[model samples]
Target: MIQDMGLELIRIMGPFDANLLGRLLLTLVLSGLVGLERSGHERASGFRPHILVGIGACLVTMAGAYGFAELSSERDALRVASYVVSGIGFMGAGAILRHGTTVRGLTTAATLWGCAGIGITVAVGLGWLAIAGTLLFLFTLTVLEWFERRLNFGGPISRLRIHLRDDSRSVGKALDALVRLGVPVKRATVLPGAGTSALLDVELARTLSAEQAPLLARQLLTLKKYVVQVETAITPLDEPTTMDESDEVQKDDTIVPLNLKDATLLRDLNDPDEAVPGSQTERSR
Candidate 1:
């Protein structure tokens, strides 16, 4: 009869523990914010995945805290929390991406890891600490977004690959012309092409604004020694091959005046055997 009474008392109080209910509510709230940010940003691990991770992290944290609290002997909650850290790492790794020279999704993965830490903190009854962490994460993602744009510091950098005919003379002339123009050339690689074709890999400076590039490109077209091709920083092997493409591609807009002497000299260089015309009017349009 005494044993039955003890068991009934345990059952009655078991479902109403203040610490247990608090942990459940705290973890749910914290994880929800983390998941919300990911979903809003359109990540693959957004919505359901993040929510699950947050809840799971919270449970793990609760387990570590409660297990330690229940022990009569010495127990380290931190030891159990360390396992959560390692487990979160595996999830973070799945979010990173690599494409040629650019690596993306690092911030998103870091955010996921951060959510786990916050969840653990909440489970350990560090309510204030968890709230502060959530605010910091949102500030970094939202406020810093505008700050970066104002400085024009973030986003993908432009990469241009300039291709020319394989002839050494043609390439040399174009290089000389570019050098004369003071265009910041980052790198130039010679790539073998089919037949007598070849590619000149070019990296340019951001100082060359999109608006200003068209004017300089008009002069490049007037040069007779070589044709050009343009591409972004990463050029896929299967990309279509083309001639006379430049990083500064121009739409057929207003025409520029061509100096007759420059035009005659260019014509002579391209076709030395033929008689050159005096008027530059042929290329002016």
Candidate 2:
């Protein structure tokens, strides 16, 4: 072997070698950030699930690239990676939940699916691209919500705590009523009750007309067949705490954001929170 030092160096640097461990570690950090954002929002799937999806995709890609390298002259790593993309659809679907016309957890599912892509990028040795993608994901999750609120681009959001009888048609009837009022539901959560009742929380970007909420409460009350208690609150788009909603949600000690003070309408329709002067309020029963 008569090889010049420069030529030998070129051969060592060029043969499509991937730093497997380094890529995996980079992917781990990237995926963790995405998961952390989702967890902050109390998503159904977060942290561990995203990390698993990313690491798994990375491993699959690496296996495709190297597993068949010695066994055959032709190798197609991208084909293996394609399966990961398509197969991840099923996992993403698990994160979505539907209740009546209101759907929740779609954003969570989307992020999980995104993490899979990040993993593949890292495995392909594009660490920089993967890092960029994770940053974008975080920005969308954290900043976009604030941006939407700041611009007032979306309508105000409100939460309705509806109590219904145990009968199955209860939810359907309530949804029908809301639709008649031209209200579009964004999210609905139902919790089983102790006796012949269940609790449903309706929230969203759907705009409510003047006196519409009070009208809704009264109209739903007419459905004595199933409707029980209906309480609506104007939910504020406050900055989420580092902890999840299960923990105490703390706001800045300085002053209550006007929207947060609006939430008091749910409890005290007679007297608005004195702390927040001129705070807007919506009423429901």
Candidate 3:
């Protein structure tokens, strides 16, 4: 009975059976390796999703090549493989995002598409080719990233949008503050703001790191009586919004009252104990 069972096990685990299992395993490993790298960088799509995509593609390709082996020669065995290619394109498109003029997640999308191809290659019995492709992908993502940083190639750029009190002197104060912070301004534009505020659009020549950005914003806020609000992002500036001449006339009238109120508030806060024009305190002083 033991000898008979051994023979049956060998029959079931033959070369054909082993090859199918090997292809599936290889697809999982190669795709998982790519996903691991992406996960380390905290990308949108990481290990498990990539592994699933790869394994699914591999299964689809295997089904195309072997599941229909008994079909007539007139039937197309490779039709399913073609569908896999087309379907994966939509997945790639979903990974991309656009912000104003800048687009992100492009590399992640390309990596996902490559993972699918690796799976298909393994399923088609091109195991060696799949291995080589995975290695190349890792090299581009890791070694090439190091190279780019060393050479300072394509460093990140940022945009700063600032809203300030609409006084003419505020613009000069804001500019002086940025200069003291050592941020090189590539472009600066002033726009009309609501009531007694003016918008300033600034593009920096050098990129600021995540840690440095908050520090810079804090410094700008302390420019004392000049800055109202500050916003920053790792994206390029778009075209400035245009204002009408008639709108400027209305704004001037509305802004004067608001400015007077703000100035009075600042004065009282700065010198709370000082007497006003006709107070009893003023008469005593």
Number of the top candidate by TM-score? 2
C-alpha displacement of 165 in model 1, angstroms? 24
Ranking by lDDT: 3, 2, 1
Q: Write the per-residue lDDT of candidate 2 for residues 1-285, one digit (tens) a residue.
A: 457876898765545544888899888899989998888887869888999999999989878876676678776789999999999999999888876666778889899899999999999888999999998898988899778765555566766778887778778777766665555677777788658688877775554433455545654555666777777654454331122112333333343212222332323222223444444532321
Off by over 4 Å in 1: 1-15, 68-72, 154-208, 211-285
Show the colliding residue pairs in model 1.
228-245
Residues 237-272 of candidate 3: C-alpha lDDT, one tens digit per residue: 333222221222111223221122122223322233
lDDT per residue for candidate 1 within 1-285, as digits (tens), equals: 999998999865554568767766776777677778877877887666765776677777666655545554655668778998899899899998763333557878888888888777877778899889988988887888657544544332334455566667766665555555555554455677667877666554333444334534544555545755544332222343233543444444443332212333344345533434654654553
Candidate 2 local lDDT, residue 112: 86
RMSD to the true structure for each prediction, in A, is 13.7, 14.8, 14.6
Clash totals for all models, in order?
1, 0, 0
Local accuracy by lDDT, each model: 0.62, 0.72, 0.72
Q: CA lDDT of 38 in candidate 3? A: 90
10 residues in a row with least lDDT, candidate 3: 243-252
